[model samples]
Target: MTARPTKGGALYALPNALWLTFFFLAPLLIIVAYSFMKKGLYGGVENEFSLRAYALLANAGIVKVAFRTLLVALAATALTILIALPVGYNMARSKNQTLKLFLVIVPFWTNFLIRIYAWIAILGNEGTINGFLRSVGLISDPIHLMYNQGAVILVLVYMYLPYAVLPLFSTMDKFDFILLDAARDLGAGKLESIVKVMLPNVRSGLVTAVLFTFIPIFGAYAVPLLVGGKDGYMLGNVIADQVMKVRDWPFASSISMVVTFVSTIGVLLFLARQKRPGVSKEQAAALAAEAAVAAGGGR
Candidate 1:
C-alpha cells in the first residue's frame, strides 16, 4: 500500500509560521499602513490618506541618493560574490574545513560598531596607511581615504563578504567534485568546467548570498554614515533623515515601502528560478527535504 503523507509537517512548521507573522508580516503591514497615511505636522503621522510621501520620491535629491545607493549596492554585491566564490571553493576543498569556517565567522564575535570604528582608525587621514607611507617618505602628505564613496564601498565589502561566503560555502560543501572531473574528461577547460558545471549547481547559494549581501547593503545606514560622509548618503540615510531630521513619517514609510517591495520582488524572482526544467517532482521534493534538514541543523 502507498503510504499516505501525514499532517505532522505543518505542526513542526507552526513556530516559524507564527514567528514570521509576528516579526516580519506585522511590521511590514505597519510600514505599509504608515506609507499610505498622511504625515503629521510634528513627529507622528495623521489618519488621513495621502500620496505626498510617494510623490516626494520624485524629488531630485532623493532620486540621486537612490541611484547612488543602487550603484554602491551593485558594486559591493558583485565584488562580494567574486571574492566569496573562490573563498568558498577553497574552504570547501580545505582539509581543515571547520577551522577555516571558524576563521570566517570570528569577525561576528565583535560588535559591528566597534569594527566600523576600527576601519575609521585604519583609514583616517593620519591613520595607519598614511603613517606607514610617511615613515617611508612615499608622500609628504596623507592621502584622503576615509569619508568617501570608496571607503564606504571598501567597508561594505569587508562587512558583507562573510555573509556571501557562508551561504556559498554551505552549498559548495554538498556539491560533487566528480562532476568537475567529468567535465574535464569531456575536454572542458578549468574555467569552463567551473562556469558550466559548478556555478549552475551552486546557484542556490549564489541566490542566497546575493540576497543577503545586496538587500542589506541597499538599506545600509551606519557604514555610509560613518565611512561615506557627505557623498555616502544612500536611500537608508534618506529614510533616516526624513524621519528624524525632517519629522516626515509618511515619507520615510513610503521609501521603506519601496525597499520592502523591491526586496520582496527580488526574492520571489530568485525563488522561482530555483526550480529548473527537466527536474522531476520527486527530485525537487528530495532537494527540499535535504534543505530542510540542513536548515534545521544550521539553526
Candidate 2:
C-alpha cells in the first residue's frame, strides 16, 4: 500500500510549490516567450512572433562574446574547484570545528558587493600591493592590477570559494576513510589510494561542488563589472548592458533564456551521472527484506 503524507507535510509542501510556480517557473516561461518575439523599434518586444532573437545569437560578433564568457566562466570554475577541493578536504578532516566554521562563514558575512569593491581597492593602480612594492624600492611605478582578466578571475575565485567549499565539505562529511586505509594496506601508495578509493567515494561531492561553482560563476556580474575591463566582461554583463543600458529587452531576455537552458542541461547531466548502476526502489526493498531475514530483524 502507498503511504499518504501527513496533513502537516502536505501543507508544508504547498507553500514551496506555490512559491516555485510563481517565482521560478513563471519567469522562465516569460523569458522563453520573449526569446521568440521580435525586437520592437522602440526598444521593447514586438507583439509579433519571430525567430529573429535566436537567429541573432548566431551572429559572429555575438557568438564571440558568448564564447569568451563561456571560456572565462569555465576557467573560473576550474580554479574554484581546484582550491575548494583541498580546503574542503582539510576542513572535513580537521579536529577544530570552530576554526572550520569560521573559515566557511566569515567571507559570507560581508556584503557581496562590498567584498567585490574591497578587491577593487586592493587591486587598483593605487592599491596596497603596488604601494608597498613602490615604497620598498621594488617598482618605480604602480602596476595595472584592476581592469584585467587576472583581476576578474581573482575576484570570481574569491567571491565563489565559499559556495564551492560548502558542497565539497558537505560531501566530505559522508566520505568513507576506511576504504582508503584498506587500499593503502593492500599495497596502494598514498596518491594511488586517494585516486582509487577516496576520489571515487567523493565523486558526488565533486560533482555538487562543480555545479554550485559553475552555475553562479556563469551568471556572475558584480565582480566582472568591478574588476573586468571591456575585454574581461562576461555574458551576464552583456545581458545587463543590453537590458538596462541599451534597452534591448528582447535580446537580453533571449540571452538569459539561453543561459537558463545551458544551466538546466548541466544540472540534468549531473543528475544522470549520479544515477546508480542497476538500482531501483523495488530492488532496494527486496534487498532490505533479504538483509532483515539474514540478520533476524524481520517480523
Candidate 3:
C-alpha cells in the first residue's frame, strides 16, 4: 500500500518556501520599488517617483546595447549547442561514463575567475598564443585579439558550455537505442534515423541547453568586463555602469527589471516548447489522484 506523506514530508517544502520568500521574492519587490522611484540629483533615488530613467533607456544607445546583447547571447547559445550536443551524445553513448563525467567536472572544480583570467593570458597581445604565433612566423605583429567582440563571445561560450552539456547528457542518457534500431529496421538510413528518431528524443535537452546557455549569457558581466571592448559592451555592462558609475539607482533598477522580465519570458517559452502531450499511464494516474485530492478539498 502507498504510504501517506508523513509530517516530515508535509513540512519538507516549508523551508524551501521560506527561503524563496526571504531571498527571491523580497529582492524582487525591492527591485520593483526602485524601478518606480525618482533618480536623485546627486545620485541614488529621490523621495519622488518617476519613469524618467526608463524613458532614457528608450534612446538608441540602450536599444543598441540590448540588441547586441541578444545577438551575442544567441550566438553563444548556438555555438554551445553545436559543440555540446555531439560531445554530450558521445559521452552518453560511451562505456567510460565516469571518466567522461570527470573530465567535464574537472574544470568546474576550480574557481571560475581563475579560469576566465586564464583566457586573458591566452588572448592578450603579448600572451602565450601571440608568442606561439610569432615563434611559428604566422604574423609579424602581435594580433589584437583581446578585449574584442570575438573575445567576449568566446569567453561566454566557454563559460556556459558545461551548463549546456550536462542537461543534454542527462536527456540523451535515457534515450532508447532500440528506437533508432527500430527506425533502421523500417528501412531508414543512418542519417534518416538520426533525423527522425534521435532529434525528437533530445528535444527536452535542446530546450534545456538553449535556456541554460542563453539566459545566463545575456546577464553575464564578468566576461564582457574582462574581454569586451566598446562595441562588445552588453546590457549587463550598461546596468552595472548605471548603478556604480552614474549611481542612478532607479534607472539601473528599471534596466534590471527589463532583463528579468525578458529572461522569465524566454524561460517560459523554452519550457512551454518542452511540454509533451500523451502522458504515460503512471503520470496519468498521478494527475488523476491529484485532481481527486483537489476536488475533495473543494467540498
After superposition of all CA atoms, the RMSD between model 1 and the true structure is 4.6
The model with the greatest lDDT is 1
TM-score of each: 0.85, 0.85, 0.85
Each model's RMSD to truth, in Å? 4.6, 8.8, 8.0
Report the lDDT tens digits of candidate 1 across residue range 182-257.
9999999999999999999888777778877788888899999999998888888889988889998889999998
TM-score of 2: 0.85
Candidate 1 segments whose C-alpha is farther than 4 A from its true place = 1-24, 275-299
Clashing residue pairs, backbone N/CA/C < 3 A, model 2: none
Tens-digit per-residue lDDT, 187-227, candidate 3: 99998997789888777666667776787788888788888
Question: Order of all candidates by lDDT, from best down to worst?
Answer: 1, 3, 2
TM-score of 1: 0.85
Per-model CA lDDT versus the true structure = 0.83, 0.76, 0.79
Pairs of residues clashing in candidate 1: none
